[model samples]
Target: MKQPGIFISFEGIDGAGKSSHIEALAAAFRGQGRVVTLTREPGGTPLAEKLRTLVLNDAMDPLTEALLVFAARRDHLQQVIEPALARGEVVVCDRFTDATFAYQGGGRGFDLAVLSNLELWVQAVPTLEGDFVRNPDLTLWFDLAPAVAAERLASARVPDRFESQPAEFFRRVADGYAQRAAHAPSRFARIDAALERDAVWQQISQVLVQRGWLGAAA
Candidate 1:
């Protein structure tokens, strides 16, 4: 059997500070002399990035937005993530399918049954090889309150379309992550976003050590 390395995804609603954390974790792995490929979903590859801009920029029907996400995801898997993992590098993605499930399905009120069906279609897409069907080894969900997160966004200079979603939508997105964390406690790490940045990093580092990622690299 061909062995592939770990795939870790950082997941959270807008303003949860996941992007910074992903970069930090990737840097940590690189410091350990491990080959790490840092990437983000719905916008990693060239074409997917274009799709991402459209998905984030233009307002469209809810279902259309969901489809665009999966499309970009497929392209990203084929052009970036799968190839890196096949070469035995650690792939740290900023977000993955869970984001779609949470944002599109949970926040936007898309039915889970529909999302499941779409996921099935994505699995069959020829662009993604069957051997690369593996999901993330771990998902770090940065839990944040809608109000607190909103305040953080307000402090920022600019807000994206998703970031500008209604407060209630973000509430559901947070709940979506929590529900997922509860369902897959082993694979998901729930971090409190209200904590200080360094404190949150400490928690993340602890998780990496506990998972044996640090020890194995050492």
Candidate 2:
């Protein structure tokens, strides 16, 4: 869909503190008079949210999990993201298709080619030049070592199926994110999540300032 809104996604392993910063970012954007749609992946619309529970808590094969996520994504895009963007609203998503690549393709050892095909089918938009893939305009990757992330998660709350996985799984997920960032350097702003929370916000703030999404003082 063609529109003027900016699509930004926050990504990281669990307990990287990315979720805590999302609301602040939204408030900052709203202060600038921008209409903001703060949402999350695996669930944005009603159906998608249901799919999210299944994908997160249910027992399923890798390919099954991957397909379920993509299905939810398609619904989410149609129901929430695309509509908001068409209205010239900023869309700040908690996670996006990248999570699938990390969780399913990297963590679960699924095929990247399969994910690629699904992405093309679900997200490609036809443009005059060619078929353009719909990716986040900016991706803030809260980069934390898996060991540190695991420690943080340990005290947070009950662990979901994905969260309950061994350290090796999270390591693979982190590696997946790193590979994606390397492949799309211009679109990713990698933040060190090992630092204090305020320090992490400062990094994000600087990125927002540089991008003209927020004022220097914001």
Candidate 3:
């Protein structure tokens, strides 16, 4: 049987404005009486948070970066996400495995095949029938042009390692997200991040309403 919880993940290159929308969506879910577990990847648990620090700041090769990311994800899943889902909560996570594919496999040019294996291994969820790979029931991909995203980030806070990368890197990352969405079109809803904030939010709300996750009146 499927788990009781609804898993929702927000994805995008930084400066795509996923943060505020994530909170807004969580609030929307709460308004509908769902218990929302708002969390993030690479840092949900104590061990994962420590790994997040290392991965974001320390200079590391593609292999090391991918390893640390998956390691943190494994811990986050075991400690936070899995439990929340099992308890029938709505887990609205800031990012998920798709970020790894977009950043490591695309931005850093890591091996996609290797990343695929890690995704399979780390995301497996056991059931009576067999183990199934866990993924978000819905993934909101805030699609934006790399240049536009960069412009938005210019006046933002200090950059992280990934955020400090060149425009070409973000281009590759955007392509990566496109590839992922194409591969799983049924699960992903692309939001045009270039739109005004209110328009973007309308798209988000429309998606949720269409999916029957929220009431039309909500």
The 10 consecutive residues of candidate 3 with the worst lDDT sum are: 1-10
Cα lDDT listed for each candidate: 0.84, 0.92, 0.93
Give the alpha carbon lDDT tens digit for every residue of 1-218 in model 3. Answer: 44379999999998999998888888988998888999998789999999999999999899999999999999999999999999889999999999999999899899999999999999999999999999999999999999999999999999999899999999999999999999999999999999999999999999999988898865
Record all residue pairs in model 1 with backbone atoms less than 3 Å apart, i.e. clashing.
none
Task: For candidate 2, write residues 1-218 as lDDT tens digits.
Answer: 43379999999998788999999999988998889999998899999999999998999999999999999999988889888887999999999988888889889989999999999999977768998788899999999999999999999999999999999999999998988888899999999999998999999999999988789988
Global CA lDDT computed for model 2? 0.92
User: What ranking of all candidate models by lDDT puts the best one first?
Assistant: 3, 2, 1
Flag regions of model 1 displaced more than 4 Å.
1-3, 124-133, 216-218
TM-score of each: 0.91, 0.96, 0.97
lDDT of 3 at 147: 97
Decide which is better by lDDT, 1 or 3: 3
RMSD of 3: 1.6
TM-score-sorted candidate list, best first? 3, 2, 1
Candidate 2 runs further than 4 Å off:
1-3, 127-130
Candidate with maximal TM-score: 3
